[model samples]
Target: MLRSIKARKGWTARAPDEDFAGAAEEWNKWFDADPSARQGAKMPVRIAGMKVPIAMIAEA
Candidate 1:
């Protein structure tokens, strides 16, 4: 018999005023929407106009 492996959702750092759910949403919106900014650069959440800290492990 074999055991199936399930996907484990990771975490992120949220702003004091924001919760994890909201922060995750903002993170996804920023990164998912052709997230390229600053002439093809990978910058931080500041590009999204968000001060909330975040840590993401994407499939890319």
Candidate 2:
């Protein structure tokens, strides 16, 4: 199935031939540089019938 659309615009580009460690390192570097990105989005999570923001949960 994947081969059928292999020539598609993003199909080939989406799958990069890089190791997991290398990719994770690159992502960590970007995440560290972007301070605002560290602040988790205001998405709510339901716990014990209470809607809590994800950032609050992350802090704990």
Candidate 3:
């Protein structure tokens, strides 16, 4: 079943015949988008009725 869509932390568009970030045509419509949309998001984790704010950390 298709689930209802909610606001996403980030997004990207890929072409059928193209790999990610290889060609300009596969780019998302918005190139100059805000970086905070992907990086500044806070994930809330609940434990024992306590809510903790967690930040997304990507491995380089």
TM-score of each: 0.28, 0.25, 0.19
Q: Per TM-score, what order, best first?
A: 1, 2, 3
Global fold similarity of model 3 (TM-score):
0.19
lDDT of 2 by residue, 1-60 (tens): 222221211101112234334544643453444322222222233245544222211111
lDDT of 2 at 30: 39
Model 2 TM-score? 0.25
lDDT of 2 at 16: 27
Across 1-60, the per-residue lDDT of candidate 1 in tens digits comes to 101212123344543443645655654555563442211122334445665334333332
Give the higher-TM-score candidate: 2 or 3: 2
Q: Give the poorly placed runs of model 1, Cα more than 4 Å off.
A: 1-18, 33-60
For candidate 2, the 10 contiguous residues with the lowest summed lDDT are 5-14
Order the candidates by lDDT, highest first — what do you get?
1, 3, 2
Q: Please estimate how well model 1 matches the true structure, expressed as its whole-model Cα lDDT.
A: 0.39
Error of 3 at 18 (Å): 4.3
Better of 1 and 2 by TM-score: 1
lDDT of 3 by residue, 1-60 (tens): 111222234433332333333433322243334222342222233246543233333323
Q: What C-alpha lDDT, on a 0 to 100 scale, does residue 36 get in candidate 3? A: 26
